[model samples]
Target: MNDDPRRIHCDRHGAQRPAFVCGHLVSGVGLGFVEPEGPQDEDASDEQAAWCDRCETARLAGGGWTAQSEAAAGITLVCAVCFEASRARNTHWMEGVARGWRHTDAR
Candidate 1:
């Protein structure tokens, strides 16, 4: 109900901030959109990736880190930790919005 940008939730918890892992599976995942360039202008782009605060820690834990599976939706950056936990309690991650995001610029 609140407007906390990072306030993502699990189907079971109602409202929760689950730990996540952002994978750079594809080179640039967060780019929003791109603009064409003129004869003398360079292309312009915008980033829409959700950068996580815990990514720094996960980045430091580099050894155990691995790329997520390639799901039908798109690249899965979030790890199964929270996903599995929610499943254990009979719920899904992102409250059934587990479908991954498609960065427009990735096209």
Candidate 2:
């Protein structure tokens, strides 16, 4: 019943989990959202597609990364290949968050 948005339960232990980002989950850590590539069945507009910030590639074929956020509440489809690449680039940021959390817990 902990009313904290930053805290989540730890699956490994019954301890109050600190707010930390997993690099394996999404690109980098921090509080940013990630939309992994998947499939799309319905007709979507241009804005619904996920654009690669690195390669500037746009997914126009099938399912791709789809994510919704406060700024972009609609579905954003991204290509699988590009999404994976982006994830790799974001791993460093995730590691940083993990390190910061560990340091804070040690105090």
Candidate 3:
């Protein structure tokens, strides 16, 4: 198995399967390590920022950046890319507290 913790989970999919790990391990699939923001650890979240080939490509297509929520993880590690994608999109798995795209009931 790959020893790289970064290579374990797909940013798009959560703990599941159907994920791909590049042999060379030389791709921009990873958005980078998510360092918690705020004054203390209580306000921290999203520890990992890795993505799969498909999701990574999509993210790049979506301007190469997304947003994050407050309930990510202190060390959100990806275990596998299951058939089902993450509850939230990869674009929402950003580091600091998400700024744009607020959930509203206006149409």
Candidate 4:
């Protein structure tokens, strides 16, 4: 059996899958995100990770994840499928362009 702490059952997925996302994303509606660079180059199955726009602004204002910014993020664990759903639900072309997300498609 896999002993990975990240492997947990999701009420929706009902299976062990490793993933996590911020609270805003779990309840996101076109909420943009800031993630590691080069997302467009990666495949969909690549590790899904992102923090919402509010967190990004706080991070920039604080010059990094200060205690306040970290608290505001409220990171939560979720299944891989849920992570993908959040990603899809939140990502928007116009929003990405406005936020200057570095992706070829956003141009």
Give me the displacement of residue 94 in model 2, in angstroms.
5.5
Writing each residue's lDDT as its tens digit, candidate 4 over 1-107 gives 54666577888886667665778999887887667565353344445568888888998899866898878889787788888888778887787667687656755
Provide the lDDT at 85 for model 2: 46
Pairing residues by index, what is the TM-score of model 1?
0.23
Q: What clash count does candidate 3 reach?
A: 8
**Weakest lDDT window of 10 consecutive positions for candidate 4:** 38-47
lDDT of 1 by residue, 47-75 (tens): 12222223434433564224522121142
lDDT of candidate 2? 0.36
Query: For model 2, how does the per-residue alpha-carbon lDDT over 17-76 read when each residue is reduced to its tens digit?
Result: 242222333343223333435654466332212222221122222133334221233222
Backbone clashes in each candidate structure, one number apiece? Answer: 2, 11, 8, 0
**Which residue ranges in model 2 land beyond 4 Å of their true spot?**
1-68, 73-75, 93-107
lDDT value for model 3: 0.35
User: Stretches of candidate 4 above 4 Å error?
Assistant: 1-6, 38-47, 95-107
lDDT of 1 at 48: 26
lDDT of 3 by residue, 2-101 (tens): 4564455455543333332222122233333222234544543334234344444544566633453112212133344421123233333443246455
**Candidate 1, clashing residue pairs?**
30-48, 30-49
Better of 1 and 3 by lDDT: 3
Scored by Cα lDDT, where does model 1 land?
Answer: 0.34
Number of the top TM-score candidate:
4
Better of 3 and 4 by lDDT: 4
